[model samples]
Target chain A: MSKKNYIRPLDIKHGRIDMGHGAGGRSAAQLTEELFLAAFDNPFLRQGDDGASFPIPVGARMVMATDGHVVSPLFFPGGDVGALSVHGTVNDVAMLGATPLYLSASFILEEGFALSELKRIVDSMAAAAREAGVPIITGDTKVVERGKGDGVFISTTGVGVVAEGVHISGRNARAGDVLLLSGTIGDHGVAVMSKRASLEFETTMESDTAALHTLVAAMLAAAPGGVRVLRDPTRGGLATTLNEIAGQSGVGMVLEEAAIPVAPQVEAACELLGLDPLYVANEGKLVAICSPESAAAVLAAMQAHPLGAQAVQIGVVTEDAHHFVQMNTSFGGRRVVDWLSGEQLPRIC
Target chain B: MSKKNYIRPLDIKHGRIDMGHGAGGRSAAQLTEELFLAAFDNPFLRQGDDGASFPIPVGARMVMATDGHVVSPLFFPGGDVGALSVHGTVNDVAMLGATPLYLSASFILEEGFALSELKRIVDSMAAAAREAGVPIITGDTKVVERGKGDGVFISTTGVGVVAEGVHISGRNARAGDVLLLSGTIGDHGVAVMSKRASLEFETTMESDTAALHTLVAAMLAAAPGGVRVLRDPTRGGLATTLNEIAGQSGVGMVLEEAAIPVAPQVEAACELLGLDPLYVANEGKLVAICSPESAAAVLAAMQAHPLGAQAVQIGVVTEDAHHFVQMNTSFGGRRVVDWLSGEQLPRIC
Candidate 1:
């Protein structure tokens, strides 16, 4: 790169991506040095190898998670694809009861995509990583021909370390365990949907896209080994995620519709669009299952965090041979909450 | 998933990916279980969590590498995107002198992509991972609208561990170090190009796509702590990679053109297509820099490996303030081996 110092600087303001940007040549190097490396600067990335090498804490189990973000309208109400990419993977690792340590991002950019937009996304991603205390250590970038790709798609992979005796898995849930929700559902899905449909409401609906590692840490601190399972209801929303947990743990769940929190604006938007709030996605919220003895403490700890201010007990695990998730409606009727049947929305996250 | 066992199995023979497959619904779950899980079956993945948690070797530094595959033709002469995706990231981690342990794959599929083709790719990916002794422990799948994506794009992230006292970096290249080539160059790029152009020859051209971790292990065993730098010349081929190392190490290099190996068919194809072999990518080959004292043993070890049978001494590190890489041509003239200037080929790997 030093030898090519005489080359022209990238025109980030007016330039558009082309085939040369992904050709693995001088142009690609220049883009990396000027855009990605500049934004994701860290000691590990500065090593400038094909990968990043770092020391891990001794005797800790490692957690790995990956996500592909293809949210349309790269810029959304409260978050863009950039921050969503980071938060989505970070939340996944956090849901495994681990502290995220590093991340690797791969970008698939379409030819003719705006460099300015790409820069904005990278900057947002870097900010999100910094806030989450994880660095983007290594990444790869590729460009597809025009019409072959929709602007850009990002895939982020996260690595984290779990402390000793942290046994968290979907199968860990037990009968009589208490189910807790960190916050309202459907904010992320409704926010993105509103943006896509050009729908406007009296009050704006912003995405609840955020990193929940700290909230998980707080819950873990409150009840070290009592928490059974942790999961974020991203796609298929809360209903599908609960069904998955039920099947995994070989237990049924009973949910009280009145207990599950939902913002009035999001509920209204969903009603207008004929979308069920139960099947809507939430980027920052999580469902945690714990013993009855620890549920109070975990819920309190969650409510103390800014991201989990609306935390509440939403349901309970039940013993059922069929592993069905049943919901008691506020109208005094019970119904089976099955997995999301069809496409409620596409590219919601 | 057990509760949803009554759902129809994915029609692997004559189905196309639809919006529901990525909508985080029953269709998505069904596809994941019937296709991805069945093909890349493993205990870690079977945990059925948002992420995979595993214990790492105590007191070893971890290495992470990522690559995105968007090759034009999904199926190439010697490999498809699946095998290429695995070998690419595995080799990147190997170049760091690390033993790869686990992998995570993310797929972006276009709506209307053939399920049969996707199954083939997934099977190939699973085979490659199994052969390389690494498991795809966690993954994500996203589907874009038809015409929004070109068939499919895959991004694979690899995690590895390096033993203590093994310090390998591009900046470690010192003046007077011996440069070694693992085998012939341009096989991967030329093979893919020939397939894309519908060109044929008396001898078929096959991509040299194979995991190099075992070969790297052999070289390390023979020359422990003697290897200075290791790199796979992928995109931009040998010339561009060498120039990158030169800039990073603040040194120059001198190469013997005649010593570098190129297959007869590959050379003929390059000549006929007006392409430079030095700028064509090679997926299975590697370039190693080591002290003169250890070059002989290291070269012998590489040659003993099936992947590096044509190993030879191709160049030597030189001290030059300009950091220029020059080669002595067979015609008795010296030429500067500059970086790849433009897009010679797009989506080659």
Candidate 2:
């Protein structure tokens, strides 16, 4: 603690948030100067404006996405709520084949929360944003009464610029397109569940919460006009996301069970919980639908990326009276993979 | 309920939020389709993508703003959490003289909260957005267990487009500029406090929550480069905001307390609560700094707008050693109006 500074130094070890911290007063400014500004040191944010202003490139179209992360158990195996918040919104913007640029984060903190834990989380988030090349330009922080909120909830909004003539959407899929999986699924959901339940597995399960914009950029570079849709299965997992794509595109999908990538440990955890691996969440994996002609190129590009080493073709699009996503089982049977019917696990972002 | 529809209709009147509502399943889809999609029906949202994509106007720069609303007693006399969420971010973007284009809303729902209340809030938000000529392009919703969250907290991010050569910021306030206020202060804070405390005044106090983009546009049109800075007095109120501007601009401010507009009822309420009117919040009011030569035209333009009928010049920028914001009281005394030091009220927004 510096003797010259008038504001009391925050007891990072065991201090609780008081109402003055969020009252938009001197205490609030101290918190911002001491914690937030120190963590996210960016030029745009240093402008000290309520909102940031920046020049847009010529002929660039803007894409924006917002995701609220309310995951329980702030820390998980391979990720925490902080990193997941950055990855979730960045991936959302990336799904449109846009170059994610700026992000705004709003934190809702519960009083009595630990400052050391908050510092760790904020540092983690800063690292994630730095690694992804998307800066947290501006942000807001609010504290609620101890019992009024969970430990912390973060809502992140990302802004990206997409070049002209680069159109990608879920509705762009067609009957003859191919669906590719960008690695193993269900790691995030399984990891969180295993930690929550204190279940031990032979191999440690880790949440696949890495940012996927770079992977998307690689795929786009390889097959620009051939890519139809890029969706990261988060809350509803792979099966539900595929169904959403099918419904939006008005086509049916047939998946090959043998080609679907799943880690052995994730499968074991899902079995123990009686959860369907198909409906489990994956933070890092993505499903890319592309034209048949470009499928090979896109798959090769995805495989070349570090995040998609296990990329494989998992499904084919088909014409159907109803938009349905069906799976071909290893036993030579077909079952409609519908949207999840109930909550698999809450707060598993 | 329609007999042909297979999905069960939501019990808006008697139902409480369950885990399935936010599980990214069929039930979640049904809730989204029946409630949110039905309320916020727009083309960009109908695309059903993770993020919304849209074209930007040529030569237009992008402006972004985000705010998290966690007001207690979710509903008040003239507004609720919904309308506040829309207006808060919209005003933030508008303060920069940008035309608000789209908004992204994320809701954190507490388990066991009433569905009817949620519907009312969402409908209010939709109405606010529509009236402001801004559509909610995308959104995310999550649910937490009972006792873990307040009924609901909404976080909104707004994207706006600004034309070239238009730059408005707090740092633009220079010595010799005239400071004009849009309208009476303390309405929103008083209204919320009255409701929270169940106070009955002779005349009902109503929140001044409103979208101010059109008003700002009118002022900007009157004198484009003449305007220096525009700021909305929100959490820390007018005095705190002025202090921030002074610090940012490295100039001092001198205010005429008598010229500052305040409703009689609001003043009385503030007196009863032992709160300073200068520190009470005003959601719809704005402080605009402009050259003395252009102050009259800007004030006239602000007065012509519906939200700023009581526009008046209340202060002027001055060259001082400490960049202090001082007020000349009606009693012929001067006092420095410093930043708020402690909590007056929490979650008043």
Place model 2 in a CAPRI quality band.
medium
Candidate 2 residue-wise lDDT, A1-349, digit = tens: 1211335777777876777778776677777777888888898888888888877745467788999998878999999999999999999999988989899998898987888888888999999999999989878888888899988899999989887657888888898899999999999999999998888888999999999999999998998788988999988899889888888887889999989988998888888899988999899999999999999999999999999999999999999757878899999999888788878889997
DockQ of each: 0.85, 0.61
Which residue pairs show backbone clashes in model 2? none
Q: Alpha-carbon error at B283 in model 1, in Å?
A: 0.8
> Would you give me the overall lDDT of model 2?
0.89
The residue pairs that clash in candidate 1, if any, are none
TM-score of chain A of each: 0.99, 0.97
Residues A1-349, candidate 1: write the lDDT tens digits.
5677636889999999999999998999999999999998999898989999999655468899999999988998999999999999999999999999999999999999999999999999999999999999999999999999999999999999898878899999899999999999999999999999999899999999999999999999999898999999999999999999999999999999999999999999999999999999999999999999999999999999999999999999999899999999999999999999879989988
Indicate which candidate wins on DockQ: 1
lDDT of 1 by residue, B1-349 (tens): 6678645778899999999999888899999999999999999999999899898765468899999999989999999999999999999999999999999999999999999999999999999999999999999999999999999999999999998878888988889999999999999999999999999888999999999999999999998989999999999999999999999999999999999999999999999888999999989999999988999999999999999899999999999899999999989999999999869989998
Cα deviation of A280 in candidate 1 (Å)? 0.7
